[model samples]
Target: MTAASSEAVAGAVSPLGRAGRGPHFRRREKAWGYAFVAPALLLFAVMGVYTIAYGFTLSFARWNGFSPRWIWVGLENYIDLLGGSPVYGPPVRAAALNTLWVMIAVPLLTVAVSFPLAVILNSVTRLRTVLRSVYFIPYVTNGIAIYFAWQYIYEPNGAINGVLGALGLGSLQQPQGFLGNPATALPALIVVMVWTAVPVAMLLYLAGLQAIDPALLEAAKIDGAGWWRTNRSVVWPLLTGTTAIVVLLNLRDALQGFQVFLIATNGGPGDATNVLGLETYRLAFLSELAPTLGLASALGWMLFLVALVIALVNQRMLRRLR
Candidate 1:
């Protein structure tokens, strides 16, 4: 045989040869890959796509959620919701305002606290792991239990009031308790929200700090920059990506989250702690006399759009930083 003929025979016979790359073999490989992914695709189709489509359709219809029939309402739900209808508009608008406050306050406070705390923890040599666990514990703890614990702490006779009395600030005590008072309820909730969010933000900041080169710190020191100045000028700029993530996540949570308000205060004290998410929840699940499912769905979509706009704005601003 010629040299080319021998090589062609070897290539055809080899286990790692053109046969394995043939059309039939490639089709079998693709079939196996699809088989592996089929279950996940099935799950998403049922749980994600179907539910979202159903909810969108429901938003345009009046349904009691149990009735087989749906009355077509067109844009009535959206109008009642956004056009300041006496029945639904006031509470929703107030809740929207409350949600706006949370969206601004939680992210700003979380970043402010977490970044500094992360900086301090990053410098620690002794008990570093333990300290990290301590901070992270709140993030991983049972949510209901944390809310209950904070509820106790906000009680009229709880630790906070006791400390206030001890400090000769008895007149400042809320007779109705922190969560029961209209004036202090939202701020108190904001504190807990910030507390729960801080650890995660701090963890992100800590990871960002560790990824930074040590030489940058040394260079700052050599240039006679103080510790505070170095952090402000050198370290802070490097962690902008981390800050953006932290801020965006917390903003999303603030806009969409309701469990904290639901479990802690139930939007009590004359709607002082009411937020958009909590209002949506109340309309969808809690309102038995009136079926506001359509309205709730409309509100949900509005919230989604608001979050999307704010997130887009945030991304644009962050890009400017870059």
Candidate 2:
């Protein structure tokens, strides 16, 4: 047989070449798939997995973040953060408690405000979309700008104090600003966090409201269920899943996010607003003495474990509710 006939014979006999998918074709297809995904995989491996692994490893070592020598301290950093060292223990414990306070307060307040707001928005027959946009605008807007605006509003003579003065309630005003006072700093930040978080939670609740069966609502009305009763009995239970999601997202953000705290208070007013994430950042980079990357990593890992346990417990509780 000639070369072409021999080639045809080989193609017909080979399993891969039987359907016109030769070895070269299969290899090329795989190569193209890898080519499309290689960048993303490489990025995730390096930025996500590798960094987490390295950070975990660094947690057990003692390093100042600039030294080449990493002294292996085993659990010294963890013990110090958990209250072994006087210098680091008190602040770390306080920061952890503050973080827990935020995590609890923000989510509960966000749910309380957002669910009602969503119900009100959903009830509106006119300008519904506009109202939603108005509420959601804060979530989409520049966070730094919003924080600054809120800072001004919380200022000694800014909008809030001005309003209080106009209403003849001047005694309610903070002369050093709400954020400037240790008594009010964390609560003020919680208010802003809830304000920013409300829109998203409301949006999610709106979706849940729409997903609710209209027949159930009609039945509740037929049974003489008023607005409050209807919402409490018929609507709230139905939105448990949505509530769980909103709670979890806000909880995670409150636990991990510190930008608002950084900009608004910088964990100041005598560490009243200091949280775990901010404490970690401060330890790693903004320490008055040497930057303790190892202790920061240990604290971060502890925070992660705390978040995990809380999330799991939350999930179970919410699931039971559902």
Candidate 3:
């Protein structure tokens, strides 16, 4: 080939040369990327991968937290939990159901309450920042503090009952106390869960609302669409991503949330408020209860599996919606 033709052929074969980099530079870039990610990978290996593996292994063995001897039970604990062993099986099933109830109720309630508030906040031109801050205070506040406050409010002679009594609706007052009655305890706890969850959901929705094109809403208005029609037709469709996020977060929280129940009800009034998370804690740590670390680990795995399934389902539903 001629010199000109040789040069053109070499250029055609070597795109990286034209870009001022080659295989060596690319290798170095990759090395730097790995170097940057090394710490995070190490942390995940130690904290996530190793722990998960160990926990799963532990679930098949009997061990108190400090015991060096781990007796291999080989599905005995699983049988006790699932194979109709009356002692452990009933509480486990009940707690699982309660957790499911909370997971369903809290997220739906949070979204239903937060969405309209977010819409209003998005439309406001005055004191919007202040109102948002006020709403978000509960999210940032200490959870235990909120639990105690709500506990007082649910007391028989507390502010809620006081107000009802003064309104001459004395019969409406919960003399047994909201948390003291089995019929009301779980629902009351759900109310508190919804209350704490709404602020975060509201913030997420506000962001989603702001990201929407204002011109679309204006066009809808020009087409003689009212508030409900505009939101139902335009806003709701656009906020699907935000809704998915909100639902996942709320579901995870409700499934794993134990602290609120620990402080507020302690799964009291005849296991009325019992849930898997709290039950796990009880089995693992509470001295008054049986220290069944293996059982607790099993429960933890069960919870993890349930959460994983729900997340996958949520993703699939979101994909279908899109």
Candidate 4:
């Protein structure tokens, strides 16, 4: 046989088979696969790559995002953000603190609230799919619609206030928006965030629960363990890795919670709810606060770093569980 025929024979050992067709057909298959994937890769690079490069470039300059050009000033944005410039100092510090709070509280709250619901959902018999869909509806709803509904519900003379008034608890009036109260605003957004996120976590946990062998639960029962004891001793121990994954995913989701807060409170009633996401947004786009593109890029990269670290730690813990 010719050199080409011999090469075709070797390549045809693949599952696709047949030396006669191997070289041309295999290359054709690969070409088609690449063609099919090209659009997605192109879209990903266009949407993600440009922004990342631009943001990084901006972080090293004073480009308020509007002006035609930027003047490079290396690390000035970082310095200004970290309290070097008195103008940008205080808000940056406060925004960092707020970001930290949301990061901690929102994920923890979602895990705590959703895990039990997941357990219950897994246990359901009748109307299981219907019930799961009901719980998941809020997650799929338009966020804008939810924000408006919440605005009405939290209004002084709205449902919440009306209920409080009828119960002789006085009206739940704050005069200013719920976003107005420094003490309550951040925590309030945390609640909305956790609530919206719980359904997804619940679904994930339920999938994990189903993968767990029923025989394990049965064995625990035969050992004279009650329901709670079986869950604690048998169910939960096996669920550690799942829980860790859930936490990691939830943390990633919570980290990007700017839009939820923006829609609900617009990061306002005076910056009470202004986390790093909102702060970066305002710096990058809002107002004429001397667009510190470099600082904004730094903020973007900081978010990326925080997310990366948490994800890495999560992977480590998951491996240890195995």
Candidate 5:
């Protein structure tokens, strides 16, 4: 009935105290935790794990997608693509090469453009929200619509050419069409890819910039560091984490780039813009080509492996940066 006795009773009844006393309380908590997570676990098993397993199985078998029958081809599909078969090897190599090119170009260009824009926007005091929204418009806009708009812009007599002509640089015009020329097609697509990708990276960089301590910048300035020098010395080092995230996301997106190429070039001009994702689509769906679902699945798995490796490497770099 005294305060100490009451406190002792309360402590004995408390779950945390009980857990400290014996293992039963902890076991019950673990059971409840699993019960709470069961639905999500089930959903992941069905949607993620099962699908991955099924795809892996399908990769070794030829299926028309409609027929119940799947011809067990084992590693023939992989061999055809990897062993440089006369039919499928060239396109796969070309597509893989292009995907690698994009994986290199898009991320670097996106970061280069976005970081400066983010720095400028972060320094602005007027209409910052409006400016950010304007920059993010392309990311939220309809992809097909943007591709169509960009197609027109890259046309022979389109806005870009018109601007060039008006600038008295009509000689620089690509009358054959930017998308039609093999030399310019991938670069043009890279430009559009960079445009759509920049806003996301810019937002990330802006967040990183805002998270930086004001004292650091002040200290740098007090030490006679100007705008550029302060950023180089203080701000850049602090942003390594954000930069890693931006690079990883951009790299993954570039490696799997499909919709833009699909809508814009369809990997044309003699496969100049073909990439792994588009190649998978062509193999799986195009009626003119042999419907090699197994081959397509092989390419998909290869892409998945490459992405996984790159992600792991980036994660290591991120840790080192930290």
Candidate 6:
């Protein structure tokens, strides 16, 4: 065969030359299909994967976030963080306490408020939609704007204290408006966080309530169960999934409570309200004023690991609930 004839002969036996695909050819096509996802894989690696790896790598370094002074210090940063660096820095113990307090307060307050509201909303007939919207208004409201507005209300002579004075509840001239008082500091943030969370959790419970079969409720009533008994025996069991989801979601958000912490306290009134998230941000970026980048990075990874562990526990609880 000549060159052109030889080429034509190979083409004739090639996959393209075949009329139909066999198993081997289909497997090869599927193998090539995986190549189409390569761009997404590459994008994720660069955007997400690389940044995480680089951040953790920076934790051991003794450099500012910028500049080329990135010298590795072996486990020094971790040692100082774990073992306590009395002379050079504040120990991480205080931040950990603040975080624990916020975490507990947020979830407890959220569940306490939202669950009752959800139950009442479920029981009532008229204006349910309006009530839900009213409750949910804060969730859609801008947190930054709310904080600034609330910040004023929290000021010494602001409207809240004014209300207290008008009601003869004692003037807040001693100047404690949920923001400054050491007692109220963490609880105030927890209250705002809980207020924002309720609408969402109430909505979840409402969904669960709606999902309940009306026929079952009626059957329970006919079988001599009162409304309260019917709800406990029939409705409550059905709502377990949504309850689990709401509790876990609320817990997760509360544990990660940064926005409220940052806005409400700025970790203030003498570090009385410092959650781990705020501490991490302050150390890493805020400390850029003095620039303790390595310390900040170490703090950040610590917070990340804590959050990851909480998330895992949340997921495990959710699974176990099923």
- Candidate of highest lDDT: 2
Candidate with better TM-score, 1 vs 6? 1
The TM-scores, one per candidate, come to 0.92, 0.92, 0.85, 0.84, 0.87, 0.81
**Global fold similarity of model 1 (TM-score):** 0.92
Worst 10 residues of 3 by lDDT: 15-24
Model 1 regions more than 4 Å off = 1-21
Residue 126 miss distance in model 1 (angstroms): 1.4
Report the C-alpha lDDT of model 5 over 136-158, residue by residue, as the tens digit.
99999998999999999999989
Error of 1 at 284 (Å): 0.5
lDDT by residue for model 3 over 1-322, one digit each (tens)? 8998987777768865544376777888899999999999999999999999999998998888777789999888888878557878888889988998998899999999999999999999999999999999989999999999999999987888899989999987899898998999999999999999999999999999999989999999999999999999999989988999999999999999899899998899889999999989988887354448998898898889989998999999888988
Models ranked on TM-score: 1, 2, 5, 3, 4, 6
TM-score of 2: 0.92
For each candidate in turn, give its C-alpha RMSD to the true structure in angstroms: 2.2, 3.6, 5.2, 4.9, 4.0, 5.7
User: After superposition, which runs of candidate 2 have C-alpha atoms over 4 Å from their true positions?
Assistant: 1-19, 318-322
Question: What are the clashing pairs of model 5?
Answer: none
Question: Which has the better lDDT: candidate 2, or candidate 4?
Answer: 2
Error of 5 at 245 (Å): 0.7
lDDT of 2 at 209: 98
- How many backbone clashes does every candidate have? 0, 0, 0, 6, 0, 0
Model 6 root mean square deviation, Cα atoms: 5.7
Scored by lDDT, model 5 comes in at 0.90
How does model 5 score by TM-score?
A: 0.87
lDDT of model 3, residue 254 = 97
How much lDDT does candidate 4 score? 0.80
Tell me which residue pairs clash in candidate 4.
58-293, 58-294, 59-293, 59-294, 60-294, 64-291
Score each candidate by Cα lDDT. 0.92, 0.93, 0.90, 0.80, 0.90, 0.76
How far residue 70's Cα lies from its native spot in candidate 5, in Å, is: 2.0
